[model samples]
Target: MKTKYQITTFLIALTLLFNSLQLKATNTIIEPDSDKDKLIIYILRNILTRSHYVVKDINDDFSEYVYNEFINGLDPNKRYFTQDDLKEFSKYKYKIDDQLLNEDISFYNLVYSRFQSKIKNAKSYYGGLLAQSFNFRKNENIDVDYEKMPFAKNENELIDYWRKQLKLSTLARIQSKTEKQNAALEKDPKTKVKSFKELEKESRLEVLKSMDELYYRIEELENDDWFSTFLNSVVGAFDPHSTYMPANIKERFDQDMSGKLEGIGARLVQKGVFTHVYELVSGGPAWKQGELEPEDIILEVAQGNEEPLDIVGMRLDDAIKFIKGKKGTEVRLTVKKKLDGSTKVISIIRDVVELEETFVKSSIVEKDGKKFGVIDLPKFYISFDDENYRDSAKDMEQEIERLKGEGVTGLIIDLRNNGGGSLKTAIEISGLFIDKGPIVQVKYRDQDPIIKEDVDPKVQWDGSVVLLVNEFSASASEIFAAAMQDYGRAVVMGGNQTYGKGTVQSVLPINQFTKFDEDLGAIKMTIQKFYRINGGTTQIEGVYSDIAMPNKYSYMKFGERDLEGALPWDKVKRANYNQTNSYQNFADVISNSKKRIAENKKFNLINEYAKWLKENQDDTVFSLNYKSFAEEKSNQEKEVEKFDTVFDYTSNLTFTSPTYELPSLKEDPVLADKRVAWHKSLSQDIYISEALNVLSELKMNNTYNAIVKH
Candidate 1:
């Protein structure tokens, strides 16, 4: 549920540079030598330079940043482009800024052309390397710290690099296969096992197949895709959140923002040569059909009564084209079931799939004989096209109403891993917690900061409130959490700090800048920086938690602070807002939580585990020898066993849906299953358990009680 980027669209009028209104409307067909790329670059440079939140000079430093970003993006693993190739590229290292100023793509052209040849050469290297059996008995190591490792010096060294990489991949597969065989033998001594040589041969063939699939997908990418990558590098130079989306990616972004898609409703991921069903969208056509399940590999796809087209080894995008069709259309899929390894042909109707998980959902939990409501907000989602479409704020309001009807005493708004969406929704949701106040301050380039306020004076939930956040809770999530924290209306809990992403982005249609009918895609540019009502910005220094909890990512470098080109933290004049007199002993509650966390053995072990994970992440070197690798893995497993009780520590809490949801659960079995699974997870979650404890301990002040009575 991690979102790599956060975006929010706002209305803006752009002055068009081009006036060719009579140009016939057509899809923009970008080619290797198309002038369209130049036009795009020119438009982007003009727009970003003028309207971006942080106006940066496109100087030598900017050029160097773009250079590194583009090169690393293309060959992050140092698998292609040797030191000599980089030396050749150094000529344009400081000239990219000049190239953009002149709308010259000489650097991009050279790199793209060289990269294509490198891909072709590397394909041959992998096939030949995988064809031969790897001698894992060799005492060697592969350093996976690619960022620190220098590129290969020559073609021979590059090929040797690929050989080592391929060997590592094959070794992993062989080891996994060997372990499985051993496990089977342990279960029933009659199980026949393959020899070491046989396993090695099988692993090599598997690696070869995967390599073929990788190259196939790479070859499927067009000149436009590579150009888009280069363009994104240029945009990313401005900030980490700002991006240049090609037409296809922009279309997908729209779908994700709307949280609706017309398809079979099963998310698919390409693994090797097969498309595996990642997850079935709840309440979707496929989920309703009940045959399609996660991990089921789709072998072939067919239109109604049409010949089945084998999608094996096909690019995921290409396969998706065949699987997705017009609404109400029939699509048949030949799938291999993961549960029993049985193959079956399942027919599904393509329809508008409203992703249920994207919306707000709540569960009632009983701890210490008190009922509390837990709301898991994935993001601050909203559909700009459909006004009536359910947004997070609207859904959240409804869910709160439902929970209140069920007489829940406390509320926990779980914003963990919520990477954020609509800014309007965040403010609206914040309004639900407080009567009315300034939610956040937005500062545009060379402009005075404008305070975005919640004018609504009606409070939805005045009881004890808790906000759960992590390093992944970012952007609009930060805005909402900051607002609540500033108002002293909720207890913020989770990681040390939330994901620091205070920048605001608006998706500007590139076609609007031109009268040309060809769709030129859109650029999601950082337009503004948001500040908390408390005068602090959530940019790099995200909202600090009231009660910092131990999590897997606590000790790791993550969130906006770790991202390259991230905006810096700042502060502004605090907004005129009143802190709520909701709780009697807020500081005492926080102190008690800290005391409990320190004394808890589970939390101590988790902290230890987090440290261990950080240590493991830092150590990227691995032994290539089979015996050494096996020994290392055994040692890791044994070390990991010391923290096995972390998962086993379950809270004795009961979670259930509201009474109104019970009938729907009975009607929709899939929904029931989802709720059951969610409830089970909540029951086992130590975070939620501690939150319940805090909620129970929180004493509502006389002001809150008087308001409730009134």
Candidate 2:
């Protein structure tokens, strides 16, 4: 006897499975060999050298960089290799360039083989150490800062290093388990808590289990993955953004950009050895079937009539590859329910999973009797393959019109953590605030700068505009912010500076240049650089905010300036453009905001938190002794507790959806809940409260000027 949910799911899955078999497969597989490898290297080098913004001669220096970079990428912790291994590999320090030109991959093979051999030895080293009991009372510490440390001097020294690492990990786990046990005892007075010795033994066993799983997964790595890393190292020497994508990874990237995937439409994350359901996509196959829910642990996955494959202990990526298939395909998942832990096989038909969260959305915020809009644009998303696809520019325009219908007096475009996307969308979106102007200037290698202009004369919202940004706001985000600042269209506010990614990359497929059946993944090469309308390039020096705000990430190095081989900041001739002069008291308002921030207690707390975070980041080396370690953690926790009020600050504001979205509350409860949660977050955001104050000041100044003119 099957439940209604199970019957519905199976019927859908069976119907889709038949349809999937009838459709023609588009992808063809090719084996990696010397001929294909030579073609890839040849095509990549030729394209990059000719089209890259900054072309470098493949000489001895470049070869040395590639050698060090590849080695460091594989074993960044100074593990897996000894001093003797480094010495032997030093011979190829300046020969990699010549070998690449000759289509030679012998160097990669040599290094990869050595890494595999060393990793095998390391497995035995950790196994032997974990077998014995660790002394937590030992007065010893391991310097976990691998960047400053050298490679192992000998095999004996390497084994000792592994021993300390394993011991430190095991000790941390033991302390964590003991604390949980103590908490459980406190909660239930009659319950008997496990002793510290018993907890320690259990923690050690758990750590050993996790390590065994990790080592097994490492051993299962196919040659294609390793070769992809090596090829990435070769192209990465040119720039950080330039790289090679394996065929499978390329397919996923394409799906991500399009915001669609053919799968059961459930977000999964690995916890320990099991894959748990995080969220089900709205209106997706699994969501419609309705049996799958959040926190359900998936034990096995089967395709069509195949035997279910146990996914426990399998890597997340590998398991996902098995679960996701072409649309109309049938997949069955053996899921263990979260509440009762009862297992059931739920069949689901694969459909296109549309990621709705990636799109632009707006909320009407009312503060101090004045309604304003906050447009949270996550990315400048657009699909190049689909010309009719919905993009950020179009979505933003629609949101603005909807907010206008709700009678919003001001607007705030929040681009925090928005690592940008489509360049065309950024240009079009910038034009919405101002009448018309040049948005950005692009310069290719030895070519004239191409000025991208928004020639439209229609100004959607010229009143009280504010742009919010943070360190993660990059590329197209920087372009939009910089355009607004240069034109004096909006008051840009947030962290010290945005992420400075001004270079443009074009993904060129290698198969297009060769006759090979292999779908050799594309080379995403940086082809051009972009500059602000005012002539400054946001290459390494990103756009600065008009009103600077302090946060926990203020002291961290996350911008393009922190990346190696990043392009330098340079200025070109300024484009002919007129400023909007939107704000009448821009200078005075900025000064007043600065004064208010200086006096604000919450801002002061943020500054203190930033300093504390920096200090803790710098102090990486930790005491291995349990007592000292406990004391250090306790003191840190006490210090953080002092700033508890920082998160407690909430504004006396209300947020609501527009009239058009109101009916959806009754139609779709899930969407209604999401909107409710989003609204609640906005009402509590301290930064947004301050932004409203800024908008009020702008509006008041405009009114004052109008009275004086009359």
State the lDDT at 21 in candidate 1: 16
Q: Write the per-residue lDDT of candidate 1 for residues 1-710, one digit (tens) a residue.
A: 12223232332323322222112112242333457888788778877887788879999999999899888778877788999999999999999999988889999999989999998988789988887788888999998778888899998998888988888878877887898899999999999989999999998887787677667777887887778778889999999878888776566666663233339777676543468885566556786687886668897787997856767656667888899988899999988765434357899999877667567889998777788999988778777669999888999999999999999999999998677778889999999987777999988787777999999878888899999998878889999999999988999999999989888777777877655556888888887888999899999999999999998778887778888789898898999988888899999999999999999989998999988878877777889999999998899889989988865667767898889889999999978987887898888889998988899999889887576446
Q: How many backbone clashes does candidate 1 have?
A: 0
- Candidate 1 residue spans exceeding 4 A from truth: 1-13, 16-34, 256-316, 319-354, 367-369, 704-710
What are the per-residue Cα lDDT tens digits for candidate 2 across 43-154? Answer: 6776666667787899999999889878876776666888999999988989999998877877887899998898788778878878878887888888876777788999
Model 2 TM-score on a 0 to 1 scale: 0.82
Residue pairs in candidate 1 whose N, alpha carbon or C atoms collide under 3 angstroms: none
Local distance difference test, candidate 2: 0.77
| Residue 261 Cα positional deviation in candidate 2, in Å, after optimal superposition | 8.7
Cα deviation of 140 in candidate 1 (Å)?
Answer: 1.2
TM-score of each: 0.84, 0.82
Residue 257, model 1: Cα distance from true site in angstroms: 4.9
